[model samples]
Target chain A: MTSTSSPSRKALSKIACNRLQKELVEWQVSPPAGFKHKVTDNLQRWVVEVVGAPGTLYASETYQLQVDFPEHYPMEAPQVIFLHPAPLHPHIYSNGHICLDILYDSWSPAMTVSSVCISILSMLSSSTVKQRPADNDRYVKNCRNGRSPKETRWWFHDDKV
Target chain B: MAAEEQEVRMEVEAVQAVYGDDCEIIHDFPPHLHVHITPRTADDSSQQFVEAILGILCDAQYPQKPPHVHIVDSKGLDENREKHLITTIENKAKELSSCLMLVALCEEAVELLSDMNHPEGNCPFCLYPLLVEDQSGTFAPFMKLMSCYHCFHSECIIRWWKWLQNEIIDSKQCDSTISTSAGNQREMEQQQQQNCPVCRKLFDAKDIEHILDYAGTNSSQPTDVIVEMDGDERKFLECESENNRRQQFESLLKLQQENSGLIEPRKEIVVVPGMYLPTTVMPTLAAIDAADEQHLDSGSTAPEAVDLNIPSNKATTSKHRDMNTRRKNRNHSSRRQPNVYPNRTQWIKKEAVSSDP
Candidate 1:
């Protein structure tokens, strides 16, 4: 059973729209290294392509990340998850639900999509073993009902990649 | 020589007109001038956010050679921003290579300063743009950490500071078995210094506390006063208090009118001399009773006697005392009702339902 949690359908607030526009302009001017923003008309959802940094275990490999911004973005953390063919890493679940702290409790509004992409890529590059989390099967089963990973009560015990 | 001197005077006057008191003439003959430049908004004579003093030195050859430009001093501008400003001015000078460009150079500096007037980049805590370009007046108020100059939305930083304080308190209470030497040292450091959330530089708690004080006084619904309870609990309490406040205000207004013949015709109220209370006492009496009601509603001790004594010094009418006692009794009875939300969701739903119509 593979279920992806449906994102909230609420429209982006005026502040969120304005901020995202600024971020888009900035990304066009100077995007983070090894990342490309897959441009779309929807400001609320962003699909970005990330290339693993050189010399890391996952180097030369590419992954797609989907970020969904809540109506009260910056006040609330964006929901970020991997697309199909999710990265095989200790912190990343098979269902593309990332266990990264910044994606959950440790997220600061000060982070941009560009900064987030950089962090995700860094997480990928530091992987010594390409494998799903130890409890991936159980977690994926629990999320089979298409639960948005934002609802997960994540325990971030690991600081090291 | 006379022609050159006259030209220099005219150039100085032009620079002075543009810069006003900001332009200082160090030398008239060779035309060495110091002009203070600050970024100004389109209108308004208020002080600009950033300012710089530029020293302009002209050689004896005048128009044949471009003047030497150097930054004298600046405030609220970083080294990089200062470099950008100087580089921009230098480029403008190079573009207009050789003519009497003193006033023009001053104008370019003012333009650049005006463009650079606002602080750049994301607020350190929230990662949002420090200055939202599209929204004209809806920008969230932000403050700089006095030590590091890292800026954050006043609300965001205050929330983080409060969270930190709560964590420290919780850790202290639970420190019995968890007291390792290393842990103790870190705890001691945390106690001795509070660091900036973004830069990790030491910042005085007094800075945030000052803003917290202001927030408490300025806003009726301050986040800190809401207390760190679950969402439902907070919402219920807020809604209940809001309803109570409205009721209290309405009652107070009614009392004010009844006592002072404000709404009723003066002829109908029949203000008999000697039997009537002074007009000034009516509002104060109503205010004291309202305050007393609020104190009781919040479950705080009613300081009615202290308030009543101050105002009663002038007009101590027996009828007013009787009314005060009656209102106090009514407040006491209302205060007995427990402020609990048994079915939180149902209460919220009911509130929503009532508000919808």
Candidate 2:
């Protein structure tokens, strides 16, 4: 296995790299409020730290988000997942895969890592309960072979939370 | 009272007479109507970025009471512009006082719109000025998606378009392979309608095809693009700092492997240390969670929370991973703030200037 999970994809295309770098610069100028980008030289991957909004159920809690960008980045959605001990949330699973649509099918090129982070934080902020998804065990087991979350055909629940 | 009713009816008829198809009268009494306004471009939307339909509803007291004018619908205007338009109309209503100001308010909106009728702020793609104002007379060219007036720099949009087309072709190839059931969804999205990068509005191939080869959107920018592309590719892998960071990340991974009892290496999918059968898993998972808390308490080895909760002194082990503003700037392409959006963004600039001390 390639040390990294992005073997199914190619290297960041020239345009994707260019666009991501632009995102990086913009992130520094004004990062999404409740999230901080953990500096990594890996242009294709970003590890950002997120804090729960003050009044949210996950308040004062911190979580790590690992975002892996595909070669066709803006055209394709990034693979975003939480690191284990994933903030116990209904949409986030035990294995760290987040069931967020923008991280998958609904991603738009105009959206940046900052926007996605904001969306994730909002998702956490709106969460009324802190627990794993009902099928956390099954989902984690299915991902035993290290299938990227992008491979899972997620049926996005309505944006209720 | 009959004469006053006649006067109201006459005013309603006058609104119909002037605006014709552009006006929609909701009620004849007291004249509640919606007026569609476009700048003086002879209906050439390609040159137009803003348009609005205004609703004006006058009470039965007629001219003695001012009508309520509000933006029924608008496009290409931000919150500030919308507020500006409403504020101006309210002030205009007060100026007209007891006069029939429906038509006057509509006129003011059209004039105000024309003044703000250019694409403003940043291109959704690169987050840079869609129309840069450089004296070199060689700024990046930009265009709007016809389906929606959302605009982008020619190169930025074209590059995204090319990637989309490539993705479609790639997915088509996957239709015959081990690709998941998403193949059907892929086939459906395979049609000529690609989404607007900004609004997700579907746009046709022709929207981008015209600029596929713009004889180059800018001579200097293209060369800069090529050099940057090569440099970025190299920078991601072979650059000294990048290799160094890769090593650091590797060392962190190795550290995670060594401390696998406390934390899991998410990327590796290695069997979780305390993970076992489900019947007996709960208590152990709880124990692991406690171990996790203790590890977090120990610090450094705790991925990001360690960095956030205890940023400075506690991160001495991975001091390089600290969030320095300069380090953040170095990893990406620096997009400058929108200082001068020469046209449509003038209101934003105006707001900033007024807010400044």
Candidate 3:
């Protein structure tokens, strides 16, 4: 109904547009100054400034996350990863495969970008004490050896950590 | 809750069950007990069946019944390589008993012929048991075994002959008859040691006689054979089994697909790289509040003990400076802050590096 594309393709495209638009709206709710999204080719990066309490670990930090969409877009999950100056959280592997349930295997078509960002924010806020995963090296090796990120199962139970 | 929210929650629960606290690791069985040998060799051309199975399990089509295990054709394998594949599979079956779901997708033609010729449950080419099942209910008992190059059931082969005699032929439904019949005739000729119509193998008639003798000895009670004359009935049963498998696969795929999308969206929040936040953060705020209440109740640790006009100061100057500062900061930050995207480059880079070998 939307375009010359097949029904499946059109549905997928509409879903992608809706998701991206929802994300943009959420940003609009409290649009941050000195932060914005940039798209170059097929890559989209969200730039952010670290503005919180002084002495907070994240204070004085500037971070960016790269989001890439497959040709299938929403029918397939977008590939989002922390792009520059990667953080070494137990859940955030060195390979950029975030052990976030919502972003990977647990994503729903209905989840807005706002909810995802909120989850990530809370994840950061509550992450008080945790170490890098013990088998971090092995996990990286496995990914390099052609294991899909979605296939690898990770355990991230400690919110306080 | 909305349907999407409910679905998301379900996905979280599923992932938690599979890879969360109290997860049970199912190890694979050992190989010596496997039912069949690999007809194909362990060459580069060999299908990586295990990887393929895992891939299928993770695919969007997963939990549709488990992907049928394929036995690659053995025409390319040497005897030793073929034996190696069979043994490897057998060893895998034994090792992955608890961890994996195993199923045997036997060819009906091979099974029928083997049933007639070999009484023991062993493959003629490599005497491995073709029967197999997994504990997880991943595999069904019966298989849609393709018979010969015909792609029809052996029973169907017989049924077709019966229908042809009855003169109720439906050529449209069974369009594959002509070529299959020709192929069978040629194969029969080859078995007779006549110049094989197709392969020209020139098999010895003595071998054919010996095989027939073996079939005669091993053939089970032919009286138990039951043929459903109605193609509709046959189609119903096939459809039932196939649909059951397809449904399971679809559910699994749906589960995986839903789970994949359930991940938290990427955020530019500061990641505390190479550092563990103090565990005291959770209990510290609560303990501080409790400590303040106790001090007020006990009338100790208050400047009132030093008689520094502490009681009056509570009403006069607010001694909650730190609390006020914290509260003020929280209030300022909690309100819609400017839409600043936290730099996530370091986090993403770390992820990339860690994912690399």
Candidate 4:
């Protein structure tokens, strides 16, 4: 448990504004063709649409991924949740704090907004198991008991799938 | 890690721009790099004016921090090149200012070399005017190569470099202590000399060397070397054998602790079965809790659940703590491993389920 110092309100605001500006600039650039993005500070919501899937479990679904940034912008990682109804995967649970090392313990300042989006896309594309984590109910219980989603420890050692 | 890596890369780029494929930036700089930049101020030369301006920027733009720049050459003290250098520096300063927030502490380095009066006192580490050299003639002249942000003697820097070099050598030797190839094992076997590199203490290296010899030699020596053998030669050999066995055991344990990440420090705990927190694991858990409580006290939002599974029974907890204390007392302490366990509720649930079944 590392000590996380709170960024000053002014610093937080400035950081948020900078990140927001960067995001806006990206949106204005060559937009992801057919996909749309929506952001709202009130809900602390960040949404992005994914287009063109074979309608398998996720086909034709305008999957909306949610991103929530903490006050300490770059210091802490964002909370990424899948808002759209989705099939369960062994790595993902009902509440969507991702199992990725990058989002939690291994986040690097070099990672930008676009890289995060690409990570999620890759996570979705590569998943093969059709279950909501190895121990689904235990994971949810841990979350409700105020444990971090990561503590449940879904071991994804097998990369074959 | 990334930020430090990037800073090194930027420094390399800066060097590359001037040297232009002629030099490679060496990574193994002495811990304290001493730099001295003396502007070539020739009379009425435009370059002198440029140098004056650059010097002013060095002083005013970045006060308190030593300038990371070192004058590579004092040749061609001409006017146009001086103006060009000033313009180059101004542009670089502007670009650096844009990254002021991330590079704040580093930028202070500019002010380090700017001060002329504080020559003898400049910190070789931070290049600050804090550290004054000992008047005793212990400081080396090579220390003037780069102003260390904190003043350190040239010999001190060289000593640090030597220590780092030796450490790398030791680590590499430790890694190759075991060899899969017969040829390499034979080479190591022949290289054995009974002595400790550190402390100049004597140790029985022959026994360890024998293990290296035995490992790939089809186990020619007896499975166990008996201590109470008849001859004095045999007794000495047995002692060496015992020492080698101990060395091998310690090395294996250290290697396991490094790779497993299960040991005392709570690096990342993904619950798994048959995982007893690595040896003497209780203190690391205690440290984690202390860390958490400190975080909360510092006013970061309280974490969702303390979620640490530090055992409750006073006897068992105390016993575990004692084990760690004893390990710390042991001479060869490599790293402290953390005691990580499944959350109490989950443990109870599993126990209940198993009991019912």
Best by TM-score: 2
Q: Give candidate 1 regions above 4 Å deviation.
A: A1-3, B1-141, B153-197, B200-206, B209-220, B227-357
DockQ of 1: 0.14
True lDDT of residue A85, candidate 4: 54
- Please, what are the lDDT tens digits per residue for candidate 3 over residues A54-125? 344554555555555433333244555555455556676666556787676555433444445556555554
Question: What does candidate 2's lDDT look like per residue over B225-264, in tens digits?
Answer: 1111223455655778876875675566567658874342
Q: What is the DockQ for all candidates, taken in turn?
A: 0.14, 0.16, 0.01, 0.04
Whose DockQ is greatest here?
Answer: 2
Ranking by DockQ: 2, 1, 4, 3
RMSD (Cα, Å) of model 1 = 14.5
Estimate the TM-score of every prediction. 0.48, 0.65, 0.28, 0.29
* Residue-wise C-alpha lDDT for candidate 1, range B28-102, written one tens digit per residue: 868899999877765332224567899999888776677888889775577888899888887888788756788
Supply candidate 3's per-residue lDDT for B34.
14
Model 4 stretches astray by more than 4 angstroms: A1-11, A32-35, A39-43, A52-57, A145-161, B1-357
**lDDT value, residue B351 of candidate 3:** 16
Report, for all candidates in order, the number of backbone clashes. 5, 1, 81, 34
Model 3, B117-163: lDDT tens digits are 21123221111222323464332111111111111112222222222
| i-RMSD values for every candidate model | 9.0, 19.6, 23.4, 17.2
